[model samples]
Target chain A: MTGVRRKSGSVPVSLATVAAAAEVSISTVSRIVNGQTHRASRETIERVRGAIETLGYRPNQLGRALKRGESRVVAMLTANLNNPVMATVASSAEAALRAAGYVMILCDTHDRPELQDEYLKAMRSQAVQGYILVTNVKSPGLAEFVARGEPAVFACRRNPYASGAFVGIDNVGAGADAADYLWSRGCREPAVLFPAQSSSTIEDRLAGFSMRLLELGGRCSKAEAPGLSHLDVGYEAARSLLDRASLPQGVMCLSDQIAYGAHRLFFERGLRVPDDCVMVSIDGSTLSSWLAPWLTSVRVPYHEFGRHIVDLLGEIWRGEASGERILPHAFQSDVSSDFE
Target chain B: MTGVRRKSGSVPVSLATVAAAAEVSISTVSRIVNGQTHRASRETIERVRGAIETLGYRPNQLGRALKRGESRVVAMLTANLNNPVMATVASSAEAALRAAGYVMILCDTHDRPELQDEYLKAMRSQAVQGYILVTNVKSPGLAEFVARGEPAVFACRRNPYASGAFVGIDNVGAGADAADYLWSRGCREPAVLFPAQSSSTIEDRLAGFSMRLLELGGRCSKAEAPGLSHLDVGYEAARSLLDRASLPQGVMCLSDQIAYGAHRLFFERGLRVPDDCVMVSIDGSTLSSWLAPWLTSVRVPYHEFGRHIVDLLGEIWRGEASGERILPHAFQSDVSSDFE
Candidate 1:
């Protein structure tokens, strides 16, 4: 430990100190230490090896990863962690990534484009190997990152502008299923409640629901409002719908949050579910079962998202082309007759 | 990019290549690049500076941070991100840390001591500057890390074996408030439902609740069940209570998730809140208002936790001693007379 000075409680011996002790270049020391001894002479390798042992120089894993232009770190940029749907997706992905020997850095964007951009830049500077974006807002930084062929997988909500790896349920199919269920329940006219800030998931669900409702010879009306949270959006949208006309026989909520907001408004108006208006929504989260009326909604296979997204990222890392993975969805209800 | 060979699409120029081109030690190049040039002569600094420009070497922030034995990264170990309470704490803390110019790496320990240990080791290797632990499980690794004078702040759940900084509501006081509310509702016989796996939060709340109940000349019974999620714990505990004896006139759920599960069980048993039995619970999350019959709860100031925890971490970083910070909580109910 001649060249490397160790204080009572100080930082560990760095590579610079090892190089200095071995009287060789840092690259030579690093190559020898990392087991790339063929690049250096035998005498130099032995000297560096001896110096490493004498100084107890442990290679920093993060520093090594930086030098190799790769890391076992994946960053997940979630729009809203407080949203149960997003939380489930993030937690599941984290577990899968951890199992695959990758540490996940979760960043909550709060559905703000600026925050998403900031996190993307910050994670890039940290040399994250991949990204799992639950992005709803359009972010230029994300689009550029994906365009550069970086390993990025869109979960739950896909970026409309960029064509990259995506893993989620078929939103249109889920919406069509909701429409069919509501129609089979002897409801003709139905109202769909959604947030004003549109996303691919919302637009596709709206398209599928309206198309299927028209095919069933039933008219569908949409109500939307601009709000910070989905709950507020649903509450305001429901208020608008109630203010204009009478309650429809059936209703479709774009999300579980939206459904809760609308249900609260309905409860305030003394309108009961299945008796006054049968309601159907997407996102079969735990909230559906936790609610009193037991919301009949289309269930997204969120638990499977982690494995699928991680597997897709593995493919991307192997120079595979972009792909879309759509998991299966089913209609769930404690009372089956609610849809009959 | 004269000294550096830039392919069509290849890795960026690293510090090693710059050092090689400068014909100086990597430490010299790093020092000059990081504006720590006092250690090197002016001529050597000039050579390294010229090489850096010619090689187009952009320093990796993470690599620099590693060399300095510090990082602007904080790792948060959450018990269960699927739990809305944990989600709120994590998301709020993320936002606060981000505003303070720090990146947060969130890991869901899922209430497993082994997982907590794994994350603690993994984060340590990553050279995270601090930790925010929402840990419930007793982890030996965590205790050792804390004992070694690491910067860690416990959120919501405090570790029984370690003395460290904590930022959360006073669970004992909140529990006493719940008991007082139940007593005011004229319910003499009260039942408290909690999870089988114990944590400081649960233990403190139960202690406060029972102590205050006895002071009020009322008796309290406890129900517990072993389950993976708090919801299942409440559901199974309620079933056990129902099968063994008659339903109590008042029930206290340890958390909002527990309340939802117990309320579902009550609904299934043809009982109603505030009518057949009065109910009170802690964790006044969004779930409280989302439920059909608005749950009377003690609202933990979750939104304030992020700021306080981040600020406390700042104090620890500045050589401040370990301190405990307890936030305030209040009783929330849409109908005040529900307690009266």
Candidate 2:
């Protein structure tokens, strides 16, 4: 151990080098360095200490974590950070995690399954303690990770293929609420605008809206466009709906961005909102209230999502049973006063 | 070395156990397991291999990474992930990093210096290969890290206390352009709205706007409110502005969100945009185009920021001279066409 030369000038002294000098195993040196010296003999611990001092080896915090088979790091995989709702959820979850003494590693999957799979593999290799998936993509790697009973919480979006702990508003209930509100506004013919790419959130919302609208003795037509961005999808869907014979009196946009896009098209066509058509959307994001035509939306309670998600993650860590947590939602509209 | 028993039944067999069974150092065992047998004799390598077979030790990928003192991971520290501009920058950078075979770790510093310092220390302890800071908080730990010549790229927000590679639009130039645009619209009296919490981006923009407006013979007044979110700042600033006896003919908002909030207030007061007040703002984000009143804005090239930031980070890694990369900005306004 004493006669071994340095690997090279560029390489820094490592734990392995200290272990070699001490003539002890790497874990023994690691144990001594990390102050877990209960198992080591006094002489052995002393020799390892001397080797560490002589070799100038600095123990890496990450290496120490690996030895303990855990890290205080949580990785959150977001489908699209560019979306305000997704951003709000991610930001809240990050704050909550930080308060709980964990650092969150956010990865924007960009709604691509391949990218999601890649990030999953990369994050797994880094040994993140748990995962917060705001993405619905069920990559094979994610399935295996979940099947292994790893600590994970599905936020905003859920993997339909697997049962896991989920924290989000009840999209189906929100959709029904939206339908009831629009129906009460004296809209016999209503329409829904959505993206063609389906997720559990979208499907559930659509289902609830359709079922409730039907029960209310009104039929709701749906328009969908194939696009990755909600804005483009809304624009295209609105255009498609406009090509028909007549317009729906009430419109329900699945998300705020979709509403924004559709509103832009409506403005271009000189069709004022609530004058030509009343509109309601989901995801009561700040943009929903800040932007003009102040969308009356079913608020998803995004601010509260962080605390719930982090708390659920902690429970999972404690070997608790995984379950769905449905937060409350409500109708919010600054423009409602004007209509009333 | 063989005398060391298994640490316990709960602990899985680790590298230390393999080394002890082989009567060799942990580095030797690691090297043999990783197929780096150049330094070890054939017998030593064979013994380590046999011990590995007997102990059933599965090498951890993260442990291997620590041994190499490198991980293909990049960390991005963002001030507020909820901010659309910051979100766009982060999402774009993530895609760029992924394409380059690197995974990005995003941490929302949330504009808190203590949080920024904590995240910096945590990420450094984890030994991330580099850092991408979309935040401007100059923590002492960050100062030392930058002073050490660590590979760091300042994206969108530059560090005032340190000289580092920066990738962003020229805020001063962008500000001057906004002033010119507002002035060209026949506005003699103008005002700029910004958040009270000043950063280099905000200060430089304010400087440019004030200087250019002065040169144009129009003294621009400024209103700022102490708030963390731009929306609140804009609303409060607008309220303060409206409390005065008069209003500025031309208004400039430092960010799109500020414009959004101020516009909401103006709408509440039954004032019209471009009619009652011609407005121009920075961050020609999608919302700027999608939202009504159709803000005429100085469009920052956010989508292109990712390529420039990642490439600059690569150059820094290559020991190249750190320099500022200023991307181009342009005037984008669908509303301008209507005015003309």
Q: Of the candidates shown, which would achieve the greatest DockQ relative to the real structure? A: 1
CAPRI-style grade of the A/B interface in model 2? acceptable
Candidate 1 per-residue C-alpha lDDT over B109-208 given as tens digits, one digit per residue, 9 for 90 to 100? 8889899888887887777888898885877877766656667888898866766789988899999999999999998989999999999999999999
What does DockQ give for each predicted structure? 0.38, 0.32
Predicted complex 2: DockQ? 0.32
How do the predictions measure up, each by TM-score?
0.86, 0.84
| Deviation from native of the Cα of residue B161 in model 2, angstroms | 1.5
User: Per-prediction interface RMSD?
Assistant: 3.6, 5.3
How many residue-pair clashes does candidate 1 contain? 0
Off by over 4 Å in 2: A1-59, A333-340, B1-60, B333-340
Residue A295 C-alpha lDDT in model 2:
69
What is candidate 1's lDDT per residue for A1-340, written digit by digit as tens? Answer: 6787322123557789999999998888878877897798889988998998887576666776866767788999988888888889998998999999888888988788888888887887777888898974877876666565667889888866766689998899899999999999988899999998888899989999999999999989889998657877777899999999899989999998888888878988898886899889998776567564546888888988999999988988877775999999887646423221
Chain B TM-score of every predicted model: 0.84, 0.81
DockQ (model 1, Cα): 0.38
